[model samples]
Target chain A: MNTIEVKELRRIYKTNIGVIRRKVKEIVAVDGITFDVNRGELFGLLGPNGAGKTTMIKMLTTLLIPTGGTAKILGYDVVDQANEIRSRIGFIFGGERGLYWRLSGIDNLRYFASLYHVDPEVTMKRIPQLLELVGLSDRGEEKVEGYSRGMKQRLHIARTLLHDPEILFLDEPTMGLDPVGGREIRQVIRDLQSEKKTILLTTHYMFEADALCERVAVIDQGRIVALDTPEALKQVVSDLSVIEIEVFGVPEEILNQIRNLPFVDTVSVEDLDQKQALHVHSAKGSEAIPPLLSALEGVRVGKVTVREPTLEDAYVRLVGGKV
Target chain B: MKPGMMKAYVHVIKLTFIFTLKQSMTDAFILFGIFVQPLLIAIMALFILGDQGDGLVIFIVVGSGLTGLWDSVLFQSGNSITRERWTGTLEALVGMPTPLAVIVFGKNLAFVTQSLSSMIVAYAFASIIFGYPLSIEAPTLFIISVVMTVLSLVCLGLVLATLFVLNPDVQRWQNGLEFPVFILAGFLFPIAILPQWTTPLSYILAPYWAAVALHMSSGGKPDILEISVPWAMMALLGVLYLFLAFWLFRKMLFKARVDATLSGQ
Candidate 1:
């Protein structure tokens, strides 16, 4: 059975412009989107910034009323049975702004636990357990203002789990964290998935979605462009190979020259601090590398490697390289 | 409400009140509004109107205390929802099973609890430091008047909170409202002495009636009719404001969800 089902959900925002004579302009933030998540599945919504990922999550969590269409969570209609739906689900948006900075981490959890209507006895036992689960046991007594960004994110996770919610909505849970912090949160997500909790996670990190999501929905321009497992999505670009070249100051002309190559499908450059990683997608795989290197004769190239297409490569192919 | 839901509401109220109290105590600006602002007003009143009489001293003390209460209501109660929005907790609070009214009520209760300290500070300043003869001739009446005043102001704050949540630009009007209420509500002086035209405005304001009840109970006069009229008026207005506040709160929440403005657009 589906834990969550959305049918043609839409959200349009009207923005006003001009000072003296104002004009109303409508922007379709979440245009006619439809998808479903099975019970106990870790579903992912992958999109670029302002791609309506947060808007969709807000609608599912019953925070935002859909402009059109309908959604039901755990069999409760989001529009009519919001209270019933809210009682059974928990959500956490990214960043440290949601918590009361003056209150201690434990105090914050205790307060949210009551809001979620957890029994006092259950709260007493669960608060510490959740704190330990989030690896915030030692820092639970400290004020939230003093916590590091990652610790606050962990506390947010713990706060959401206070009521033992059956479904969780996490929007970019590791958006701004360091690698270790991101890994820690990913591990917690993995553990929750193991416990058979239904989760809807929206993220910009392709690898994170690929690693955790049982089914992924690629949303772009307020619509779902693709929906499938990571492996299946990656299959869209299976005929192509990604050739990555680490170089110091490769000129734009060189990139253009590589892009002009007959066998190259796409050439994208990523700034790697003092160096740059040039990703060359080719239909000819390793066979295109000889001409690609010869075309960049004078460039200071570091590492050269070729690999199978990743979810990111698939994303670029589907979204037309916007991400 | 069912028993389980009622229990949940009570738990939310308790938790919200405690956490809001903690948050207010740590907020430097809230601390200043609750304690420092009233203290300064009381001192200013003593210095400017010191030589008037003992009756005037009591009036100033009570007026300063009410000023603090009004200030707390204006800032804390009016801005509570907006503050939650800025903290990114408004969505979480709105998404909860518990109604938003219960959470806001709990928050305002905490502010009212904090507002009580203003009265204590004012009384202490007037009787102890300034050596003024302050007495409550009708102790029961005085207590009743104080409770009614706080409740009435909280109701007004509730309305403001809902209004501000729906139309955030109106928040600037809060600063505009502070002194007008001080003047119109007769917090520092009698509305009778102001003007013939201002009486109608003062008559409708709950705080004006609250001041009348407080003044009459504090032995400014022994007219039972004067005390009872304002007392009854304040109670009626409290009910009216509460009714209006709840209605507006529900409307605001519906509009917020529809417009996706719960987090303050």
Candidate 2:
């Protein structure tokens, strides 16, 4: 059974610009998007910034009414049966801002449990259990303001589960965290998936989507450009291999030369603070490496490796640009 | 509503109240609004109007106490929704199955509980430090009046809370609302002495009736039969304000959701 069904969902924001002489402009944040997630499936919405990922999540969560089309969660219409849907679903937008900073972790959970109308008997038993699940049982008495980013994110996960909702919407759950923090949250999400909970997760991190999502939807400019399982999506670039070259001070001219290679499908340069990782997708893989090295003859190349296609390569090919 | 749902609602309100109270107690600014400001006002009143009469001292004490309550209603109750927005919790609260108004109601109840300290601190400062004779001629009537007054004020706060959610600029009017109630509500003096044109406005205000009931009971000069009018007026207005509050709450909720204004999104 499909736990969520969205049909041509659209959102247009009318914002006023200019302080002294105002003018109204309509920005299409989510334009005619459609998708569905089956029960117990971990679905992912992948997009770059301003691609309406968060806006779409907000509409499904009933925090923002769509400008057109319709959505249903667990057989309830998002527009007309919002209250019913809310009771059966939980959502967490990435940030520590949602939890009361002054309250202890346990107090925050118990307080939200009452809001969700969990039975007192259940709450008393579940609060401690959730704390343990999130690895915060030892620090549940500490104020949330004192928690690390990872701990707060875990507490957020615990808070959303208080009602035991059937569907969870997580928008960039690991947006700004250390690798360890991000991995811990991913583990918790994996645990939830094992328990047969349906999740709709949005992230720009292609690897994270590839790792956790059963199916991934690549969205751009407020529309779904592609939707398929990780392996299938990666097949878009199956004929190509990714050549990652670590280089310092490789000028833009050299990068453009790599892009112009006859065998090169796409080339993207990611800044690594002090250096840049040059990703060159070519149908020639090992054969193209030598020509690529000569192309960077004047620049300092650190390490080079050729690998099979990844979701990032697939995303770049599908979106026609770097994500 | 089903019994089960009603029980859940009450449970939410109770927990929200306790948490709000606990949260406010630790904030030094809220503490000033609840206790320190009222205490200072009582001291100022004692010095400004030295020993004019026991009735006058009690008048200033009650006025100062009510000022604290008014401050809570103005700041805490009024800002409850906006604070949620600033903290990024408004979206979470709105997405809950429970009505946002109920949670806000619970929050105001917590502020009301803390505001109760204003009355106690005022009384203590007046009686202990100033040695002002503090006595209620009709103790039962005084207790009843105090309860009705707080209830009425809380209902008024509810109305304002809904308005704040709809028009946050209304919050700028907070300082604008305080002194008018202090003066026109007759917290410092009887409304009769005000310009006759202001009587109609005062008559409809719950605080005016509350003040009359408190003053009459404290003076011990009037029987229950005589003071019943103000008591009755306060209760009637409390019901009316509560009805208005819920109505406005529904309207604001619909507007906020439709306009995508909840959490100022």
Candidate 3:
């Protein structure tokens, strides 16, 4: 059974601009997007900045009302039955801002537990268990302001699980964390899925989705461009091969020359320390390499390799408008 | 509401009250509003109105005490929700199954309760330091009036919190609101001294009734029949402001979601 059913959901913001002559500007942040998440499934929403990932999450979580269309969580309408839905769902936005910095981590949980109306006896037992689950049992006594970013994030996870809602909406839960912190959160998420909780996660990190999501949706400009399992989504770029070249300084002219090559599908530049890594996608595979080097003959070059396209390559193809 | 649900609501309110009170106690601004500001005003009022007599000295004490209460409700209770928005916890509170108004009510309760210290602080300053014997003329009526003042002020706080969140432009008038209400509510003097036109305006304010009720029982020397007028006005105004707040809370939440402005940052 589907835990979440979203049909053509939309959210538009109208704002007035200017001092004397005010002009109303309508921004369509989420435009008629539809998708579903089945029970016990881990769903991922992949998109670049301003792609409506957060907006859609806000709509489903009842933080923002949809301007048009409809969405249901566990068979309750998001608009009309918000209270019924709020009781059944738990959500955490990315970053350290949501939790009370002045309160201790355990106090934050106690406060939320009260808000969720968990029985006082149950809260007494559950708060410590959740603290242990998030590996913050010892530090739960400290004020959240004193916590590291990772520790505060762990506290947020514990808070979300305070009432143990059936559905969890985590909007980029691992955002702005070190690799260790991100991995720890991912481990907690994996554990949650084992407990049969339906999870909807949105993140810009492609591999994080590929590694954790049961199904992934690539959204761009308020619309879902592709929705499938990670393996199937990668098939979008399966025909294309990636040629990576590390160079000291490939001037704009040389990069443009690479862009103009006949078989080159797309070329993106990544800045490394004192070097620029050129990612070239082409169906010509290794046959497109020699000509590419000739274009960069004057530049000091380092390592060069040809590899199979991954899920991130598929995302770049989908969101970068190459597909 | 079922008995179980009512119990749960009480539980939530109690927790929210304790949480807000603890958090507010750490704030220096709140401390100043509740303690220092009122004491300072009491000293200044005693200096000016000192030689009048013991009855007027009690007047200064009650008047200056009300100033702190008003400041606390005006600034602290007023910013309860806005402060949550600043800390990014407003969205979390709004999303919960518990009503946002319930939590805000608890917070205002904490604020108004803590601010009662202003009255005590001023009372102590007058009786102990200034060496004036101060006593309530009608102790039972005075206690009842104090209860009414707290309830009415908390309800007024509900209105102010919602109004400030709804139109930030009104909040921009926050600093400007303090002294005008002080004058109109007769916190320091009688509203009768103002123009007759402002009397009707003062009549609508909950603080004005609170002042009249507190002043009468403490030192104004009103009979039971006479003091009942301000008590009735406070009760009526409390109900009116609560209904207004109930309506404003719904409107503010709807607008916050529509405008997607819950995250002030």
Model 3: how far residue A7 lies from native, Å:
0.7
Write one digit per residue (lDDT tens) for candidate 1, span B216-235: 78755556676788878988
Give the residue spans of candidate 1 off by over 4 A: A249-257, A294-300, B220-226
How would the docking of model 2 be graded?
A: medium
How far is B69's C-alpha from truth in model 1 (Å)?
0.7
**All candidates: DockQ:** 0.83, 0.76, 0.83
lDDT of 2 by residue, B119-195 (tens): 88898889998888887778888888888887787888888888877776877787898788888888776777889
Q: How much of the real interface does each model capture, measured as fnat?
A: 0.85, 0.77, 0.79
- TM-score of model number 2: 0.95
Top model number, TM-score: 3
The parts of candidate 3 lying over 4 Å away from their true place are A248-253, A321-323, B220-222
Q: Per-prediction TM-score of chain B?
A: 0.92, 0.93, 0.97
lDDT per residue for candidate 1 within A165-190, as digits (tens), equals: 99999999998999999999999999
Q: Distance from true position, residue A80, model 3, in Å?
A: 1.0
Positional deviation of residue A146's Cα in model 3 after best superposition, in angstroms = 0.3
For each candidate, the alpha-carbon lDDT, in order, equals: 0.88, 0.88, 0.91
Model 2 deviation from the true structure expressed as Cα RMSD, one decimal place: 2.0
